[model samples]
Target: MGTRVSIAVVSVAVTAVALAGCAGEVSDVERAQAKVSASEDAVAEAQDAFDAASDEFCQAGESYIEALDRYGDVLNETAPTVGDVRTAGADLVEPRDDALDSAQAAVDTQADLVSAEQELADARAELAAAEAGPTGTPAPVDTAMPSASPLAPAATVDRVDQAESEFDAALSAVTDDTPLSDASELFNSAAVELEMAWLRLFADAGCLADEQQQQAEAAVRAYTTALQQELTTAGYYTGAVDGIYGPLTVEAVESLQEAQELPVTGTVDKATAEALQAELIALGGVAAQDAVASTAAVQQTLKLTGFWDGPVDGVWTPELTEAVAAFQVELGVEPTGTVDAATIAAFEQAISELQQATPTPSPSSSDG
Candidate 1:
């Protein structure tokens, strides 16, 4: 990845946390439950957005997947077309270019929704298991994670997945020659999914100074890529990853718009952009993976200070929670499951402070 995005883990930002005061008072379990629920809501929203973006693709005159599949080559290389007939000297809009942009947006939106759902699913399972068994708090609430919202029930996750499958298959079946109205319907469906997704995330992930900016940027990138990947994965082409903003992207956009029954113009207006962004955000926040990998990572950091004693299996069992609380006690910090920047830095500092520190390893995605 060419982009350099810095994550502002709130736990590490002590001053910021202090100034902000309490975000809310929720038990570790309660917070975890909320995050899961919020995640579920987001995925559902993404599903709707996916449907809308898909509609846009169909409206541009390409109903089948082949239009996206052949996007980069056809639009990037073809001349612009604005009218019905290819006249000897008439000014034309690059139908292919417009089609490509809309198509890519839809693809990226779908992926974000899927990933969010997965993450939430994992988190929810672990939280549920913890709640069912022991009584003592395993770990303090994860203040680091986004707080919960009642509106985003966990059930929505299934809806997004279901919608995605249907939308993708239907979108793929579209052809450039498909009826404009049908294309428009698909685009509208995708938009609906996307819109719902965005609202869910915004509500769940309220504004936190430390991580808020970082989250916003991440939301945009994740959604954009997710939208694009949907088309590419489905077999559409949207030029290079160099971010050139070329005609191929335009064509993909137009194709998607035509499919949605939106204006055939190649531009993505404010309403379109907002709708796409909202859907992406919702999908991005929709799911949680089991805290297993996360558990291991947390345990390793705490063990140096004797905060953890149990095995590191990615599960957030009671033993792990006790270890976390102990670590928090020693650090004079709230022992929530949330790993804010302060907790992370103290963990890092403690490794050196107490010679028991095992050399911390980077995350899987960090190394290569």
Candidate 2:
């Protein structure tokens, strides 16, 4: 009876051990399967995230390209007047800034996609290891896919930067108190730089070459029109504000030259431009109305008679008054600085005497 009881206890112990071993094997399999399932879910989630990131990257790339194209258009716009230049320049600021922002966003989105793809690969590798009982190496992670749009070339980027700078300078030139000619020169120079940039882009995208060239030509014409408009405002140009420098425009230029005592070249030279600007400023006030003609005449007479040493620009300054007083005292007239009929008669008589006393030299005999 004792031997039977001991055998029975040993049998129970063996049965219990077998049951525990089966449960342990089952739990191991379940744990491995759960790990694989979780890894797959993680990989799927990562893939979804990567896909979303790629979409965002592509969208941002498109936005940047659009902004760049708009900026190019602004640079190529025809700004015929100061107002036109100002408006076009103002329009450029927003797109220029947006392009910069979108470029950075695209780069950032690409980075996020790369990271998400890496996470997915890691999860897949984990899943493989889990399934294979951690014995073999997992597959290699794939490289990140290429982006929809290639990165802008360094030269292209540089050109955009230069264009922005030049555009800003051109805007400032017109908005400030810069002279008309100086502003026009600045605009022309900025346009030239912008055209160079556009040409570089056209080299890559030949389809846009003709349009860009036409736009550039238009811009040049606009600058010419601006010059004509400025000259017209100065009362030196009576011709149409057409961009062409025709005979009428040349005649107006000659008129300006004669007024400013410059060489009568009938051309819009730098000196002519400066003179026109000065005349415009002078014409802005009553000084242009010939209202001070009497004062100017007195000053001219005083200067010719060696009494006044001031400009005869029609300003009733204190020096001019003093000069008048001196002339009156010398002529034994009332010392009042004001001019009247008596003063004018005295000045005319003095001028007549001086002219008669001056000996007329015989003209040199011409050689036969």
Candidate 3:
């Protein structure tokens, strides 16, 4: 009976040890399976995203292709007018930009999908190893994220920026002397290169857009108007300030450029604008000097009349403004802080009255 009891106790001890070992193995497998499940969920989400992106890309591409076909059809016309060709070209810009943007999104999502699939495969292998037992060794999976598409590198973006600037410079170089055909060819070629560069940078053809060109032209027109006004003030321009950049304005700009010893680009470049600004400053300084002289004269007159107690300095200080206002009040005129036509007329009358009111000495013979 003692031997049988010892054998039963040993059997119970062996069963407990086996159960513990089984539990540990099951825990490891459960953990690994959970990882695989999560990875699969991630893959499903990535695939959905990729599918949506691809659909958008396809739709955008089709729209752009249709627009391009229409443009080509216009060009293929037997007698396509300049206006027709220009309108067609303008219509193509937005669709092309949208297609490019959609293509970039698709490429990004595809990369994500690829990365997710790799992770899921790795997870599945890990689960298989966990289920195989302690002797099984899983091959290491590369968990590193893939690098970005080479098209979207910083260096490529920089190149695209440079290309855009060059295109702008080319557009600015156009003038009356540039032949229409030559200009068209130059712009068309540059635009193609610029569009391609933008695609590589995962961006739109901003520099090639008609809206951008219109904005630039509007800015230049405004600058030209201001330039014409300045030139007219400086005695260089004799035409009306109609804001139309005609030959007269061009001639005036050239004359000013010659006077300033700048390069004779009739259009107002940076140096030309700076020269005009300098002219404006110089003219303002002369006008300011004249105003100061006039103010000093007025202050002297006011001092003689005993209406002002301040010094005859040309600086129009608060004291000067107050004194002027006070003098205006006494003269039955609106008390404006600065001199105006009405104020000047009142000053003339005051000076006349003060001169007449003065008692002139007879001869002062004894005093002499």
Candidate 4:
């Protein structure tokens, strides 16, 4: 009887030990799974942050590009002397420096994204290892990280640095009162360099759409034509109204550039374009400028009012002429292709009405 009791006690003890071991194993697995879940959540949060940073960076880059465009406009025009160039460069210094800061921020954000991606990858590996059970080693993680962007990190950094250097060089050239001719070359080089940098950044960041580049190019050409027209109206140019940048056009452009105190490149640069626009505006509002600038403004205004479908390239095609005439009829004005003061006022009124009628969305409504 004593022996049997001892045997029964031993059996109960063995069963309890076995049950405890199983419970401990289950607890370990549960803990590991929880850890993996937490890590996955962290990874998701990091990814979202990275994406937001990337978006901000891209936006900053675009703004910088716009600033550059404005600066380029000023730089490409004719400046009578070194002092004029220096003054123009001074006007752009603040904006150019701001752009540089934005570019640096973008590069920093990109680095942050790379780090976040690495953390996410590490978390995934940990999760995988946890799922492999006791005595199972995790698979080797790939050390060579891959980027979806066309530009590698090293290349991106290099390009950004080069762009900064080029911009600095250009700014220095202007600020130092370099000869207008020499400064023009430096400015052109800087612009080209910065453009290359922007191209790479835009492509890598997935921000530059094919249509955007085309539209930019078209806008530039249109601005050039507008400049030519303004010069012609001012009695500086006698070339054809065609948008070609030929020798005659160059001479005319140089003359205008000299008058406006811009660096003379004989090309329709950003400064030249703006000077022309300002001159046109000063002449008598959008309606009083020579055909191209006037027509372009009217076309843009009409488009804003939902009456024109043509490109705003300063071209007076028959379709545009017809569109203008139709707009005129609607406004109870004479069906002349010319945009007179009455038509201009009517267009402005329509634009104001459209803007006022459009509802401003609430923040809460947009949150979803």
lDDT, model 1, position 184 = 37
Which should have the higher lDDT, number 2 or number 4? 4
The per-candidate count of clashes, in order, stands at 109, 0, 0, 10
**How good is model 1 by TM-score?**
0.26
lDDT of 2 at 233: 70
Q: Note each model's CA RMSD in angstroms.
A: 27.7, 29.9, 28.8, 17.2
lDDT of 3 at 163: 51
Relative to the true structure, candidate 4 reaches a TM of: 0.43
- In terms of lDDT, which candidate is stronger, 3 or 4? 3
- lDDT for residue 91 in candidate 2, whole number 0-100: 61
Error of 3 at 226 (Å): 53
lDDT of 3 by residue, 50-127 (tens): 678767865675565456444434533445556665566678669968976886787777777677666667667777
Clashing pairs in 2: none
Q: Kindly report which residue stretches of model 2 are placed more than 4 angstroms away from their true locations once superposed.
A: 1-79, 139-150, 175-368
Which 10-residue window in model 4 sums to the lowest lDDT?
359-368
Model 1 misplaced regions, further than 4 Å: 1-25, 62-93, 134-368
**Global local distance difference test of model 2:** 0.47
Listed in order, each prediction's TM-score against the native is 0.26, 0.34, 0.34, 0.43
lDDT tens string, model 1, 241-356? 31112234345555655655666654443333333333334454331222123345454444433455555543445555555555655655556544332333233223222332
The residue-by-residue lDDT of candidate 2 on 6-58, one tens digit each, is 33433454455457667565443344344344434444554455455444533
